[model samples]
Target chain A: MALRVGVVGGGQLARMMIAPAVELGVELRVLAEAEGMAASAAATAVGDYRDAETVVAFARDVDVLTFDHEHVPQEVLAALVDAGIPVRPGPGPLRFAQDKLAMRARLAELGMPQPDWAAVAGADDLGAFLAAHGGRAVVKTPRGGYDGKGVRVVRDPDDAADWFEAAQGAPLLVEELVDFSRELAQQVARRPSGQMRAYPVVETVQRDGVCAEVIAPAPHGGDRLSAVAASIGTAIAEGLDVTGMLAVEMFETTDERLLVNELAMRPHNSGHWSQEGAVTSQFEQHLRAVLDLPLGTAEPVAPWTVMVNILGGPEVGDIDGRFAGVMSEHPSAKIHTYGKASRPGRKVGHVNVSGFDLDDVAYEARAAASHFD
Target chain B: MALRVGVVGGGQLARMMIAPAVELGVELRVLAEAEGMAASAAATAVGDYRDAETVVAFARDVDVLTFDHEHVPQEVLAALVDAGIPVRPGPGPLRFAQDKLAMRARLAELGMPQPDWAAVAGADDLGAFLAAHGGRAVVKTPRGGYDGKGVRVVRDPDDAADWFEAAQGAPLLVEELVDFSRELAQQVARRPSGQMRAYPVVETVQRDGVCAEVIAPAPHGGDRLSAVAASIGTAIAEGLDVTGMLAVEMFETTDERLLVNELAMRPHNSGHWSQEGAVTSQFEQHLRAVLDLPLGTAEPVAPWTVMVNILGGPEVGDIDGRFAGVMSEHPSAKIHTYGKASRPGRKVGHVNVSGFDLDDVAYEARAAASHFD
Candidate 1:
């Protein structure tokens, strides 16, 4: 019998896992939230992941349990563990990833460089944050925010009051709005056997609160910055005892300070470039880590790889026909389309282009990605 | 809204199409013949391929229709074409592949080389075939046979009558058992627009009537043999007006004659190595051909790529444990498992290993593939 893997959510991450799991001869089952989600490896049971019964039933027959997202409730994870089911990147590490305040605090405790932050309860806490950050700060909710949601820029104390009300009484983390030079991400993986590997830092471009494009090996290929990012990624894997792939989102301040922005405990949107960009894809690495197998090489397949997200724009026309045209133009460009309906601002798919030259590849990747839009 | 591709069968060739269909941003759907079959790309509808209503329903939403095997009933294919649905490598070419005698007749009409063959109804036909070749002949059913099935060696004409009784009512294609030095397979892809390209001729090794391994860029790099095979493949593609990938199985006789052995109209078992062995995988090439898209590169990624089939043997009792062990042993060998149940002599999957040295890589690939067996 194959090792049964129960993924907690159903989306492209689960869908992408289908290929690698099939390649590695592992049968993957999913507790997909929807009837026709991705991850078509084995039979799927549709149910709510937060419901402990649903999760427990899904885990009961599987050899090991992993997740598609970090949103599963702590009670469900605890129940699975109590019942002797194996859950990778267990509840302890997941909690830190689930809550931004906790993640930042944990990183600070480990002597990692990060922007000065404060845990806030309400409007009163906003005043304390602004006073310490030159009358301006970035306020974010501790949980359930992604792609720039549940976040706000507060220039005045009066502005902070609206965000506090909008948060709906959720805990907030306020940080200094540093003058950052660029945004970068360090993608890493750690196995249960304590083996860890890190990829080069990637320079990221953000557009309207979502990742627009990523240039792997970063621009100019800064040796010092790459080393620091690698150390930070490795440190988090050891410090938090994370098992499976972990990606640390970072902001490079003008003064060369690498502030830890977010921690994702699975293959992230940032690592999508590695599909054809690297020798060992992040999806394959995730499987190896969770299964406690020896990690494959992480060398880049090409000198440069540029990934551009296919954000759904304001259009109701045929996206498929447009994609055909893009493929006709650049037959070598690799495109991954999620079986998703197009909605304005939604992440429909992504295109990655690789070449000996970065500028050439980035242009082709960005053009193809936005062609449908 | 991607182009929906409906494959008529649910075997590993259809399973391999999942990867390239995903990479190329096309929707690939399969009408699998059985449950738990490995076609993991798009939605699969399980039903009878021979039933018109069942097959029609599977073809309902698909833009282009193709096959996982060439054995779809002629009446069923004609009905689909009558309904104006596009079937790549359409019924015309499929007929030659479906029946060996018809294929040989067509090849003979085209002045193609072949071992002495005769269409026989009974012992009388076998008598004529054997009298010309030392009173020994090989008999085969004209249709529905592959990998040594429906084929037999007969040394006497009287024995042929008993063999005919054994075949029930199937017609026979008898050939003189020629002295063959090696076997070669030429994989080629043709677009509906008449574009075509061929990969290097690959030498295949069969053990116990099953393809055990394939050595790409066949040893000694026989340019003459390569050219003859490519010419024959292209001739067959154009002569039959094939609109998708075609793999022409050939036997290189001791006299240097390349004789047609069998034919497959889809991305076949022989071309599975092209997934990582060639620049563009056979799956991707098949998709382009069916869709009439421009052909991609067909160059080898490395100097040598050896693909070894995994045929389950008695030692397959602990398949999962063996797979894990093989992965740790050869990290570079690329193994593709079809997520299928393994019985004795069943093709579970194949492992492809590519490197600078053919001998070492071929051994490594075969070892990794056979480890589970």
Candidate 2:
């Protein structure tokens, strides 16, 4: 009786899980989007995840079904659950991550701190909400928005008219633009049996709304911020009955209060620093939690850890060719690549550096990551 | 072009190399002994290492050829080199690891410290050597012996008569049984370009000639021992012209002098602790050295780290069932399984624990490993 774990997506998140899966003696089978995808390193079945028949066939062989992303359709997820296959985070909680308006309303009901937001049906509704809150607002589509797509900053209601037309009557959300000092991410894991653990909050630097780097134990983020972040993570895990990994993306406002901004029901890019910094990586923890196994410690192993993502640049050559120079310059930096080809703005890999000195670790991580570019 | 590395064995060593190979962006292809071997996680070709044509064909696509074990028959290795395939630790040096007689002769010529030894052909030769030295001696077949096999301790020459008959005139070595307090292993990686790095000497515990545990920065091991071990490792790397990972298993006598015992020309069991304990893992270092890439730092990440091997026991069920309790109890202990099936006394996996305190780390590592047993 092999303990088989099936992952729904074969992106980098799923690819990174291969190392821990091999170490744990667990059989992992991934439903990759296509051949040569990031996670093709493991046992893979390339098929459309949107097809219920294909996804259900993949789930039939696994003890538990989980995901690399929260993009699976709700109806398809329901079929798996109805068939008695265990799906972590279930469809009920994953809907929040799928739809922005639903997440805002749920957080409000749960009495969680968030930016003032409202669901707008059209341009007229957006204009009213903008007048009531502030002149400027962030407008977003409820579904399919990620990494700056399906999102826009609006000074006037007309700016969102195109989105309303594209939505075809689906509700959209407009919220007051948050003036945050810095962005932080809190990662937490939960088992269906109620066991839970939270990692140290990390500060993330973004370029063009994409994560560029992450610093563990966020700089100047004292006990107050940590406590607030942990509380938020724990509440989300319990409130949503989420099993497996949960990432709470937060905004530390200029006034010093933390506001929840986004939610990811799987391993997030911001927690990539933990792969070298923490005793147990989030990818490993996710497997344990989803399998109802005891959770691992989320404690930091180093004083400071910095992770910089290697976004594809103009240089077109084999990545291994650059290893000699970069490795010679920064021998302690740990590099991880997704086995992906170079394409501008794509996250091809990341570098992690952990040490006693924060500045040194940060510099090494950034320098090593930039080498690929 | 991608940097392709071809390994000539499909054991756990090659399996473990897959992780680091993926991280380093090197496309690793292994010539496995059979289908479904441990290293099948990577691109693999099932072939016999003894067959020169199969091995050479396998090496055709690789930029550099290496080995997961020294058992790849010297002639086949020579053929690979003759074909202009870059083989790290070229057959000239790999001969030392393949034959004890050659290793001992070379070490003696290099003026290295070792037990008084002789190449014995028969009972008569054994008797003369035993009489000249102490009555008690250790006898071993020069080639194809591992994990206590083909080795015996004897006070009478008659004790080695059976081995002599089995050898049928193949060479054998007999050495005076050195009185040693504990065994220490120093692991070093060398590149063809003359770059080298040494890891801290670790105290190894052996059970029936198999490595059972390793404690890094050896307990109560002073600076004098560390310097001596590092020097021995450096000398061997330069003296043997060995390229890639070299493990020197030595005897730390009660009198505080070191005697060379065994040599491994690739990643060794004693270096397994480096996966969690050191800044650069021996597997990754081996890849770098073999590829002639710049080596990484071999510094220890923690003050103390303990590694305990997981020997398969009689428990006949899924190994994953035990992981829940063991991981819950010792969340920080890192477990590395070879994706092997359970069999009594087999080297199935290992556990590593690193922290500030030696006693605590040792306890956690042993306890977690015991669960599998």
Candidate 3:
């Protein structure tokens, strides 16, 4: 019998996993949120992730369970564990990604470089954190936040009055606004047997808190910075006993120091560049890690690999028709489109261009992606 | 709606297409021969390819129809065309791949390089051809032969008595065995609009007439021979009006001449290295060409890429257990399993390794594949 992997989330992450699973001779079954989710292309069971009954039933047949997103409730995860299902990035480590407050506390305990943070229960607590942190702070709800949602920057506690009300007494996380020069993302994969591998640190450009483009190997990234990023990624994966992919988003301070910004226990948008850039893609690496197989090499095939995301514009239209023109314009560009309905400001696809020349690859990637707009 | 592709066979060629299909956002529906064929991972319709109704029904839901192999009867293919369904490498071109006699005749008509050949009906005819051609010839059934089946080298007319009896007067293709130094394969993709691209010619090693390993950019292959191979591919694709991928298997004579051996109208074993070696994979290129989308670049990513097939040995056990050790030992090796049940001498999977040194890449690929044995 083939190894059956159950992924809980029907987004592009799971959709991408389908290819690797097929190549590995593993059967992939996805628990999607809806009928037409991106992962509907695979063997999927549609249901709400929060329902323990639905989740447990979905996990019944698979030999192991992993996730495409960190949104599954701990209660449902715990139930699967109780049923003796092998869940990668088990509930223990997934907790750190589920709650911002928990992640901050853990990073602080590990003596990792991070901005000053505090858990705030109300406006008074928020005021105190702001006053202590240069009169401004980044406030975020501890749970259910993603893609720039459930997050706010405030100069005064009064500016977060709506968030405080919406939290309904739940503790919110507040951190000092990071004064960084640029953003970098490091991806690492770990097997249950403790095997680990880290990809080259890449500079990620964000627009409205969403990843816009990624330049792999981070141009101008000295050996020291790359080493520091690699060490940090390795530390987090080992410390958390992560059994799959872990993405550490960091801020490279002007002082040449790195600060942890956020943690994702699953494949992140930043690692998408590895699809064509590296010998083994993050999607394939995640499957290897989850199945307790040795990790594949993370070596970049080219000197530079540039990735540009295709965001859905304000207009509603099909992206399929643009394939001919984009391919004709840049024959070497690798395009990966998610089978999703285009919505305003949504991520629908990405373009990857790899070559020896960084500037040429970056320009091609960006230019090809812009046409899809 | 996405462009739907319906493939006639459920073999590994169609199975490998699942990966590129996901990235292209193209829906692939395969008419598998059985319930658990390799391509069951996709949207499959289990039915007989010989049944015109079943094939037409499967074609109804797809935008274009293609084949994993050329075994589909000519009548069934004609039915699809008569029904207004687009079939890549349309019936006219596919006929060449289906019958050796037809292919040899067509190549001769085009003034292409080929060995001396003749069509024999029985022992008397075979004796005449053998006597005329050094008293030795390679005899083969004209239709429905693959791998090393239904082909034999005979020195006497009575040597193929059993085959002649079984054939019952059916014509057999007879040809003089050419003295060759090595075998080479060139793959090319063409779209309905006439756009074409050819991949680098590669040297192929055969074991019992089955492709065992392939080395891209055939070693010692000078620019002249490479140019000749490319032109031959282009000519065949254009002259035959073949759409999608066409693989031309050729023999390089000891005197340094290229002669046509066989033709395959879909992604063939010789092009498997393109998955990691080239900017665009044959599987992806085939989809784009068949869909009438502009084809992607066929540029090689690495200087040398070696591919070794993993044939099932004399063992009934699963090869999955060996994956961990193989991956750990060769972290850079790319493995592709077909998800088929293991049977002695069956082709279950393949391994690909790419690097600057041809010898090193070839060794690694062979070493990793042997572990599965």
Candidate 4:
């Protein structure tokens, strides 16, 4: 029988895994929240991931369980573990991904470098954090925040009064906003048995707080930074007991320090360039890791690879409608689209270009992605 | 709406297409001969492909109709074309692939290089052809032949008397068995609007009349041979008005002459290396050609790519059981399984290894594929 993997979300990450799953001869079943989600083709069950009964029922047939997102409630995950289901990135490590405050605390406990942060339960707590951090800081909800949601740059404690009310007595995470020269992301895959592999660090560009583009191997990163990024990524993967893929979003401060910015326990936007640039894509590596299979090599296939997101898709039609223009203009660009409807500021697709010349690769990726704009 | 493609057969070719279709955001539906075929994931309809009504019904909702293999009856294909369904490599050209006699005649008419051949109705006719070709020749049934089936090498006319009887008055194709140094295959994709792109010719090795290995951009094929191979592939595609992928298998003779051996109107085994080695895979190129979308570049990502077939999987368990060993030993090899039940001599999967050095790539691919044996 083929190895069966159950994924508990129907977003693009799940959709991307379908390709590698099919190629690897692994049966991937997705528990999608709705009928027409991005991973609908592989969705075998439609139910709320929060419902232990639903998620457990879905995981019954699969040999291992993974996730497309970090939103499954701790209780639901614990229920699966209690039921003897192999939930990778089990509730133990998932707690950190599901809650920013937990991740910050865990990183600090592990002696990992991170921006100074504090758990602020009230206005007074937040005011004190801001006062010690040049009167400016970043406030974030401890849970349920992604892609700039539930995060804010505040100059005063009063600026986050509404969030504090929403938290309802729970502490929110507040951190000093470090002055960074650029944002970089490092990814590592870890198997349940402790095997690990790290992809090269990449530089990510964001617009409106959403990932706009990514350059693999992070241009001008040099040997020290690359080694440091990989070390930090591997250290965290081991410290958190993270199985499957872990993407560490980090800040390269003006003072040459690499500080942990965020943590994602699933395939992230920053690793998308690896789909065409690396020996093994994160989607494929994630499946291998979660299954406890040996990890594939994470070497880069090309010297440079650039990825540009096609946010919001085309203005009038689906992303497919723009294939002709983009394919003809940039034959070497690899276009990947999420089966999603066009909506302002929504991520609908991405283009990847890999070659020896970084400039040409970036230009081709950006030009091809522009067609979907 | 996403562009939908309907494939007439549910074999490995169709199964492979699903990965690219999902990644490209195109909807693919397949008509399988049975419930649990290789392409079960995309098989929307289960019926006989030779039945015109069944095929037509399956093609109703798709934007374009294509094939996983060139075995769909001419009548069934005609019905699809008559119904105004966009059938890529339409009946007009598919007839050449369906009948070897027809293909030989057409290629001769087009002034192409091929083995000297004749259509023989009885032993007497066969005897005459064999007497003139060094008393040894190859005889083949014009229809229903694949993987060395329905083909025979005869030293005397009486050797093929059984085949002559099976013909029942229809003529069998007889050809001079030319001595060749090696075999090679060239693939070309053509759109309905005449756009064309050719992939590099690759060398193929046959074991027990089945393809066992392939080396992309065939070693020792200099600029002149490469150009000639591509020209022949494109010429045949254009001459036959074939839209989608066309594979032209040829013999590189001892005297350096390239002669046409066979034709396949769908993605063939020789081009499988492209899935991981080339910028645009044959499966993806086939989809683009059939949809009339601009073709992607058919450029190799590495200096060399070697592919080895995993015939007749493990004697005890499924291919998945061997992943740990193979993956651990050869992390750079890309393995692709067909999700088929293992049977003696069946093509269960393949491994692709690409890198700057051909020797290492070939060794890694072979080592990885050996795991399945």
What is the lDDT of every predicted structure here?
0.83, 0.89, 0.91, 0.94
CAPRI-style quality class for the chain A–B interface of candidate 4: high
lDDT digits (tens) for residues B155-230 of candidate 2: 9989988889988987589998999999999999999999999999999999988889999979888888999999
- Clashing pairs for model 4 are none
Give Cα distance to truth, residue A134, candidate 2, Å: 3.2
**Tens digits of lDDT, candidate 3, A1-373:** 7888999999999999998889988899999999988999884699999999999999998988999899889999999999999999999899999988988888888888998889888889989988888898999888888889988999988888888888888888998898899999999999999989999999999999899999998999988888999999999898888889999999998888999999999888999999989999999999999989899999899999999999983265645667877899999999998888888689988999999998899999998998878
Candidate of highest TM-score? 4
Q: Indicate the worst ten consecutive residues by lDDT in candidate 3 chain A.
A: A313-322
| DockQ by candidate, in order | 0.36, 0.69, 0.90, 0.89
| Runs of candidate 3 exceeding 4 Å displacement | none
User: Count of backbone clashes for each model?
Assistant: 1, 0, 0, 0
Model 4 lDDT per residue over B1-373, tens place? 8899999899999999999999899999999999989999999999999899999999998999999999888888888989999999899999999999999999999998999999999989989998899999999999989999988999988999998888899999999999999999999999999999999999999988899999998999999999999999999999999999999999999999999999999999999999999999999999999999999999999999999999998768645658888999999989999988888899988999999998888999999999988
Candidate 4, after superposition: displacement of residue A25 in Å?
A: 0.8
Sort order, DockQ high to low: 3, 4, 2, 1
Q: Model 2: clashing residue pairs? A: none
- For each candidate in turn, the interface RMSD (Å) is 2.8, 1.3, 0.7, 0.5
Model 2 residue runs over 4 Å out of place are: none
Selected candidate, larger DockQ, 1 vs 3: 3
Encode model 1's per-residue lDDT on A1-373: one tens digit a residue: 6677778888888777776776666777888887866543343788999899889988898877888899999999999999899898899999998888989889989999888899887877888789877989998888898899978889776676766777778768999897899899999989888988898789889988799899997886578888999999999988999998899999998888898888899988889988877757898888878888777667676678899988884368766567667766776677787777778888878888777788799888978777777
Q: Which ten residues in a row have the lowest lDDT in candidate 1 chain A?
A: A34-43
Ranking the candidates on lDDT from highest down gives 4, 3, 2, 1
Model 2 interface CAPRI class: medium
